[model samples]
Target: MKIEEVRQHVTTPLTAPAFAPVVPRFTDREYLNIVYRTDADALRAVVPEPLQVEEPLVRFEVMKMGDVSGYGPYTESGQAIEVSFDGERGEYLHAMYLDNFPATASGREVSAYPKTAGSPKLYVDNGVLVGTLDYGTLRVATATMGYKHHALDVREAERQITVPTFMLKTIPGYDGAPRVQELVRTEITDVVVKEAYTAPARLQLFQHVLAPLADLPVLEVVSASHIRTDLTLAPVKPVFDYLKGVRS
Candidate 1:
């Protein structure tokens, strides 16, 4: 897909803050990636299978300059991809990783997918890990989406699942280390039926696939900003402001 074409699909919110220039910027930085993640089961029921999952467990980084913040690419230790599964859950999993490549006088590119005239899409089977790019479009601009699904989709999962919360663990250090990294968790906050679906909706949650983090605290970054994976998790208070706050 063309980079400009995808940008046309979603609109940014007007109220969000603007990007500020980076302090002690990595002026020679290579490229940037913008990543967004939500639960799969809820997403599966809503979006058609093809786009039901917005890429898989790839690393997407957050960007920031000053007061404003947004999405960006990971400097190391991360990749991002779009993925989905059958309506029934049976451990069918898929993942994708993309490298960060900035736009040049010629064009922009993605790490795994090949470059097109401007923007490129995923090459599901046999995607290379290096030196490939797609002509990406549009620099990060401020905006929003309508009827956002920020809240986890719950109510509908009732009867299908019986647990209030569950946890996930990530492979520690990419080695057979004994580290127990945690991911998705579910909490039964409420049960409500969605207007789009007639059946009862359950709200089980998928946790932060990408670490809930900020390179700069109390600040928002722009899309394609670079973040360091080796970097420690940003500090958080008990308040637990998960999305754009200090990590608790």
Candidate 2:
């Protein structure tokens, strides 16, 4: 293949290309997000500088992507902390565990999402919305919420999901040092909220070596919601380059 042809390929033999090449869209995405308040000091310890933690809050999400445009169907579970970047309120994605390999590769390479191989299941059981995440044989997180207790405003739901999301992207250099280290920002646009509901919820994060979600420790369950939506992920843009001190 010519150099131009090689550059056009989205997926390499072993690595996935950047975000712009592969556009992923999701339809009828079922999400169950559990919001919790934790210790303020603990949150400040992990959240990076330049991103301010206004409240000690975290959103644990369990989602089932039914129809993905480019990648196939997959289930995902992750944790995002409420933070502010340059006076703009947003969420910083801490970690994600997914079952599909292609989605994992693209999510990490393209968007700098901290994705790893794991099993995440989100389903309804006997009228209860249930979500679970397991790393290998150990269960890391489990959440349950009442199914559709009350309706939620579609516009407010859209705003919650469409806000800017921050990520710490890193690539190793040839000498094993940091090559590309920057703060990536991304958001979902053209969101069509089909249905939204809220109900009482509970979350538990177990302590494990691989997925140490308990490090954050859920202090109180603030709220829970189930949302069905369709949206296209906007292209990733770097907001801060840690090594170069450049802003995009």
Winner by lDDT: 2
Candidate 1's C-alpha lDDT? 0.25
lDDT of each: 0.25, 0.89
TM-score of each: 0.17, 0.95
> Residue-wise lDDT of candidate 2 within 118-147, one digit each (tens)?
899999998899999999998999999999
RMSD vs true structure, all candidates: 20.4, 2.1
Separate clash counts for every candidate:
43, 0
lDDT per residue for candidate 1 within 179-214, as digits (tens), equals: 433222222223222221111111111223232222
Model 2 CA deviation exceeding 4 Å by range: 14-21
